[model samples]
Target: MQNSIFKTAEVTDYIVQWLKDYALTSGVKGYVIGISGGIDSAVTSVLCAQTGLPVLCVEMPIHQAPSHVSRAKEHIAFLQNKFSNVQAVEADLTPAFETFKNAVPPSDNENLLNLTLANTRARLRMTALYYFAGLHQSLVAGTGNKIEDFGVGFFTKYGDGGVDVSPIADLMKSEVKAIGKYLQIPTSIIQAKPTDGLFGDDRSDEDQLGANYDELEEAMLAFENGIQATNLTGRKREVFDIFCRLNRINQHKINPIPVCKIPKELK
Candidate 1:
């Protein structure tokens, strides 16, 4: 297979310029992003900072792991030192999550309950971002990559997927990492395992998706380009099957929400 690698500096410059143009034309004051200490968020925040516009990096922890918070702080500090426009804030959502979760109807299905609560965590973070965005007239920057956003629909609708602009949404996971390295984001964050941070546990993106990002990205690239999953063999076939199943099941997320169209005659 041909190399899937991207030109680090070129991609970084493109995204940086994209952010600059977006803020200029959109008339937003600045950028607001949830810095989850994951590679995608770290890279997105750095790109926003590079635009020389005021960027607020909010660490909205909801029963967050110590390591995740630590990495987030580290990245925040790193960017603040490098860019005058970059600032960090903490919005602890643990109390909100607790209040919200307590009100949910009790369920015998632990899995269903956990999933609902996890999605709640994401929505709360989204709410916090918008709260500040409205206050500062800024836009919420999204961090989902192509694989998660378009392939598996790994993001919670109107939660992590909620944003004003997604600078890296077109890029794959591998491409995001490449840009992360080029931007000199903290090595610890770039190398850290990816997570949604909504589960309140240390479960990773791979664990939830049932496939590693590299495998999923490759399979998805093929699938989107009209390559059939049935054409693969051996381990490739396994990965393709996982990708296909996820794409089929989560297709709703990437598709337009169904709306009833009334007939003109009836009207």
Candidate 2:
């Protein structure tokens, strides 16, 4: 996590270095980021831009997307105006999302409508990202952060989380915000409470988690810093329990499915 003195040269060094590390790991020429007019996307776009690679900031808006799309465009324009090699692309997802919803059979899992809808948006965004990546020979710069990953298994599996490289995946939500501020990302984006924005306006990542980022941050610190929780509140303990069950249940989502392979010579 980033310590204080957000706009210091050291902070910039850390951000740039993280981007370089991901580029080395993925061997990607550039980055394609799903920019949602939110802090995570803004910070990621800025960091990737700082790496001196071309950046594709894409907006994949489903039917439920808000005026935020315009906000997204403004942010993308800011990136292009201020930085080099930043291109903006908008991909409409209304038809694809509706078609998938229409195709789902009536009897297939009645209880997971919100889940299905959210996953649908995420997967569609992924489809667009991968296509853009193929065109540019770049890696998808994923927007998920450590706080979201730790709490309640919130992100859609292999959907938004599907990416060749993730710059902010290791940082907590506050850490992400601190970096965003240091990077001079738009304050509206920085202050935006994150939502998957998959479902209608009623949806939010924190709401789904049944716990907010503060609790999530505490739990993450407890695990990472080996800190004692002697003064932990009852609500926090409840949130911790939720995190525990979620970490266990969503383990499958985090890991790639296994397949048994016979030796080629045996054939």
Candidate 3:
């Protein structure tokens, strides 16, 4: 399945309008976004700013790498300079993370402990975003794209996934880049490798997923179109398997929360 072509200008306009409509209907003043110095967050913040409403760009760094921190600051500065309604704040989460680390019991499984800590960072950021949202009467706008949110479920549940509105959830990573370029997002950010910044390392999303966004996108599209993997071979087959495995394992994140239904007779 081929990726859909979209005009950046038209799509941008549509998203900005949709944001405005949602905010107006929900009675919120604006949006609060946690900028991660990645392409998705930068694009989402810009889209939110384009709505001509108050946009709070929060930088929540939990022992974040220098490069990620710099890129996030650069994006926030760019947004503030370009959009009058854009505001910026930094919630240094390193200390909070350390405190939480001391509180949790030690685990013999280092890998599990590291993964759990990484997810805890994301959830901490989510908490910070909501704090600002509640203080400012704004909605927490999500930065997830199509591949991450639906294809592979590559987000922390109740963390980055816990958002009031998703402005770019439907757009693919490539599509988000196109929109980012159209919006003239900082060149440094536009070219930077995608990373979740949860592990406080230079490792990228590709490093974690074992497949790049483009590869993942292709596999996702193919799977959605019911393309049989039996005919695939080599790298394509590997990527398809990775996508399938992630999609299967992360269904709990992608789908609505399960609710046990009571039988009518029980009432």
Candidate 4:
């Protein structure tokens, strides 16, 4: 049974402990987060800052991103003021994205453009992030929440998921909202409409998944709870199928690769 009342401090403690555990496991010295002005990233920024490691917040906005680029920077500024170890850096990916678009003209392989273009943008941002991470000698932190991670294999493989540590990948969207409030994150961030801002004109993640966060979260939780009765309708079911497929296909994303090698003696 799921807990009815989500405890704030309990969630915050989990996040803090996640940061500590990552430090111990990776033997890394510090942390880095990409602040897209979204709630999950905002919340993760605060948690990583509180972990007492040097937290480098990178703002990588492309041409299509709305004015939230500045809004994101403002939030980072606030975090910087509050957290002594926080440092703000900017890496504009607009030029890089455009270069990629031009350099890799449309191919006969349509999926390449649809899939690869998206991956290109993601890799560009992380490309800039890797430079900063190397300079800061910090681990790249991921902000994907459980709901998004479950839907449509929603992220580009080896792109956005590329990171040294992910603190909230286990928390659902609803749980993340609760965690944000507990951490005293700005209500503006908490209430903002959901979007990936990958393309302009209010294009959002839900538009991509054909599933909303509420249903996605519920279905994902239901799947985890071992209940097979839960299901979606029409296009929504299609989205759930994507979620299920990704979960089954990408189990390796969350674990180390398995290798079965023969010892010379056995051979």
Candidate 5:
């Protein structure tokens, strides 16, 4: 689907230029990105490479699926061949993740434990990204897109969401795919099911959300335009409810962190 507001080529160029400007102004050597072998990361990494600055693409996998690992390696190789400044590293974090799991106290609820561990994977990856960023004087460039970052808040707070800069957070998922195609991101990545890869399984993001990106995007646009839920029916209504429910419950992830303030006199 074509975005009515911006052409793909133009948007791609704009983002690349924006990244260059942000990195130069911040005096950072480049960007450190965690490559998940998904469209978002592939596109974001490509854009970062276009900046002509050192771009470290780190694949920090913790019990990752083989397909995700292969795709990630393929993307890194593609980037290295195309951009001289792009570098790749693999930090197998399975041992670290196992150690963390052992250190943490067990919970009775298996479901909650699974979910918490998934988020833990993301946090571990985030820590790895920052470690490389600090060591190389680079900023952590986030790969979140519009639908995940804002619409449904699908990203892990302070995990995948922790970053010095968000290069593609404003673009919708469809737009990101378009940009990815324009950048010639490996077809394997562009066509692969979008997965967080936190669960070490084959489940796609749609499987977890109970709705696909297209459906969620439609609901998001409708909600933004003040379309009432009552007007929607059938699957539309169901998807809208899913969008709203997730949007509402995940506000803590979407909004700025709350800060407690004391009165001036008390201070």
Candidate 6:
């Protein structure tokens, strides 16, 4: 069964009020978010708009698929019609990304080069969001979910993860979708397959992550609760193994960087 803890109206109200309180107390004139035409961004943008603060939804398409861009615009239109404080803007970073890619010498290692380029795109989008946020005296609200940000480190450091505030960072992917439906987010966006929109090859998030969000979230919960992998068998054991391996490999993203402390004598 899908996680149902966050499906309540109270959770929705709590998040909306939380965004309102944070923006008001911080004295930010508004909030800015990168609208990726996915459920996560859709839910996040709606929450920010519900705060009645000026919400800037930026469509930063850097070599993005045409359908994704269309859906983003559609969502933006929906928000504009629903909330007076909501505004949409487009910051196409294609040329900028091209310049950055061209600056780097061609590599024989295609996978490494592609990975580096994908991360560059994410960072570029982050920069664009901040640029608008600065102009409006707003905060950059992130669209990350718990499983992606904390569970598997699916986000790039200082890329999509670079934000002034994260309103839904604790919710899982399923929870985000549930909230999306509650928020009356456009059906197209709510049902669209999740993607980072980073890879030029059009690889879906599932293709890159190996396992889907449901399996990942289950593994994350089990791991957090001290569930032993040895206790599982058959398909359960296989999924657990994948989660453990990914968690071990991606711990650096979730953990703080190591600092070598010098002893008093050395100092």
Model 2 lDDT tens row, 80-169: 988978888889888988898798775466658666777878988899999999999898988888866644456777788888776777
Q: How accurate is candidate 1 locally (lDDT)?
A: 0.89
Task: Pick the winner on lDDT between candidates 4 and 6.
Answer: 6
Query: Which segments of candidate 4 are over 4 A away from where they belong?
Result: 24-27, 108-112, 150-152, 229-242, 245-267
Candidate 2: C-alpha RMSD to true structure equals 3.2
Per-residue CA lDDT of model 6 for 183-232, tens digit only, reads 78888987787888887545788888777888787888888999998888
- List the candidate 5 regions with Cα displacement exceeding 4 Å: none
Question: Tens digit of lDDT per residue, candidate 3, span 1-267?
Answer: 224567889999999999999999999999999999999999999999999999999999888899999999999889988889999998998999999999979899999999999999999999999999999999999999999999999999999999998889998898999999999999999999999989989999999999999999899988999998897999999999999999999999999999999999998
lDDT by residue for model 4 over 159-249, one digit each (tens)?
A: 7778777788877788788888777777777887777766544666777666677767766765777755354576556656766776677
Error of 1 at 88 (Å): 1.2
| Superposed Cα RMSD, model 3 | 1.2
Q: How much does candidate 2 score in TM-score?
A: 0.86
Kindly list the per-residue Cα lDDT of model 5 for residues 1-267, writing each as its tens digit.
Answer: 446776888888898899999999998899999999999999999999998999999999898899999999999999999999998888999999999999989999999999999999999989999999999999999999999999999999989999988988998899999899899999999999999999999999999999999899999999999999999999999999999999999999999999998899997
Write down the worst ten-residue block by lDDT for model 3.
1-10
How does each model score on TM-score?
0.96, 0.86, 0.98, 0.84, 0.98, 0.94
Note the clash tally of each candidate. 0, 0, 0, 0, 0, 0
Q: How many residue pairs of model 2 clash at the backbone? A: 0
Q: lDDT of each prediction vs. the true structure? A: 0.89, 0.78, 0.93, 0.76, 0.93, 0.86
The stretch of ten residues in a row with the least summed lDDT in candidate 6 is: 1-10
Ten-residue stretch with the least lDDT total in model 1: 1-10
lDDT of 1 at 22: 89
Query: lDDT of model 2 at residue 103?
Result: 88
TM-score, model 1 to reference: 0.96
